[model samples]
Target: MNQAFRDLFGAKVAGAVASAKALGQVDHSGLKGALREVLVRSLLRPFLPPSIGVGHGIVISAYDDQSTEQDIVIFNRASLPCILIDEESGLFPLESTLFTIEVKSRLNATELEKTHEKAARLEKLRHTPGETTPEHVIPCLFAFETDLVQKTDLHRYQELIGTSDPSIREICVVGQGRWFWTPQGWHHTPPTDTYSEVAGLIDGISSVYERVQATRSRPLLLNYVD
Candidate 1:
């Protein structure tokens, strides 16, 4: 809020971006997965309240449709039940998911298109209306580098991603230094802009899931383990 604090926060975000860049330079695939975990641990998990949780999992609707494994999934386990969970994967209840993120080691058309399709599929899964939770789940795509998209042509990418869907929000090419959102348009920045963008995400998350804890919904369950 204050100028002094703002400057401090900016420095921290800048540090995260710098760290990701260094990690991805050599082992783009392996280390990038590590970077995704880092982003979750630093940018997301800390911000998530106790009632809610963040994980890398797939969403499962009542119809048995399963989603592509997402890099980051913010769900309220305190309120809803998980359809399945094992050592390898977690199949979450669709309505329980509040937000989902797709992570990429680099930004390219192929990756972008795939992410778009995945988000669209998630959008089609209808939620079971019970308690009043956040009506729309925010879908986000974040990358550590860019190979196809140029900083100046963010609008071109936006057109490809489409604007009609409320479930999906925007593509944050943090390593490339730009982001495209249907509502706010494009944000062009330097390659090391990951932290600042993450800060924006925190603000958005706070506003969207602000009321979730007040209406925590729990389902009937039987827990047994060997």
Candidate 2:
């Protein structure tokens, strides 16, 4: 912790600390933006390699020309999701691994398409001349607050994941609800609600981020539905 921040948080910090500690234990339905961000950072920070870095609320350049930016892009997704670019340490550069995360209160096809375009465009830029190419395939993490993804809708999502590059991993976090992660060519049992299930989902999502730098696993699916 920075000295300046610590000084400011002295004495009265215990309350905030307590609240923060309780976040992971809280149900997803009760998750707020602050709490979710805290949880993700806490879980991801530990697994990161010292060489790689992490930031919060950072900008992700999607195209070589800087035409698009995202909430966060780990390395580069100009060509493949979760791929990291060594040229420049931002999204849209060559050889950079990118992880595109979508945290929505709810999701729709339109939103999904937009996210896909962002990832694809970044992938295209990775190889373009004068544009940095990310080395890693970007991964996708979708966290939501809902129960039960519609059967037809599940098929659409499965198709999207199938079309993505093999390096990319897709994980969905559904808060305090019930859902399933069924990609085409694979069958996953429907999720059921239970104690610690939501926390497990969050943990799995964090695991992906921690291991993203070294894995070629298919998009790992994490459904946290009631």
Candidate 3:
């Protein structure tokens, strides 16, 4: 808002980024991944309505197969046949999940490829009762920074991943930009500033919140298998 607050906010973001980079050098650990995931989950959960929750879980099939562990799961936990939990982790019904997200402190081609693979697995899982394709569940990838995908390289990456898995619908590289697909196709909004990126990131998710809620199907005529 004010120049003083802007400067303070910039300094804070820089500090957080520096901390994440330092954690990255420590090797494979939650220290590196959890920071981003927790921040994103906390920031995003409130933007969604009270009916939705943000947490970690997997989508499951009727036969008991499961999707890979999601970094964040936005779901309607109140819905029966949607969530089941045990000593380890929770499982979410594909129909009840509004979206799944993978968060990275930094994104690279390797991480990007792995993210796609996970998405493919989720795409293959069957939906709850009346639901069809996993296209209703938005796939998203978020990063604090990146060494992988970029504007100059986006075309090639898009071509490389073509028609393989359901593609990520929203990509927000904090302090960088937000990329998303629409009826008009792929659109990229380059970062204006850290504040704008933060705004855009939340706003991008907010749009999905509105969209999924708007188009959500009501399960009628339930014939309980149990």
Model 2: ten consecutive residues of lowest lDDT = 217-226
**Candidate 1 wrongly placed segments (more than 4 Å):** 28-31, 83-89, 129-134, 148-154, 161-167, 175-195, 211-226
Off by over 4 Å in 3: 1-16, 63-65, 81-89, 129-135, 148-153, 163-166, 218-225
lDDT of 2: 0.42
In candidate 3, what residue range of length 10 has the lowest lDDT sum? 217-226
lDDT ranking, best first:
3, 1, 2
| TM-score winner between candidates 2 and 3 | 3
Counted clashes in each candidate structure: 1, 51, 0
lDDT of 1 by residue, 1-226 (tens): 4778667766766676567767667755756775656664576666667767777788866555668888787887665666446532477776677878887656677777777788888877655444665354568877755776444325545677565533346566654444534455544434432355556666666666745444434333421111
Candidate 2 C-alpha error for residue 165, in Å: 6.8
RMSD of each: 4.7, 12.6, 3.9
The candidate that achieves the highest TM-score relative to the unseen native structure: 3
All candidates' lDDT scores?
0.63, 0.42, 0.67
Better model by lDDT: candidate 1 vs candidate 3? 3
TM-score of 2: 0.46
TM-score of 1: 0.73
Query: TM per model?
Result: 0.73, 0.46, 0.77
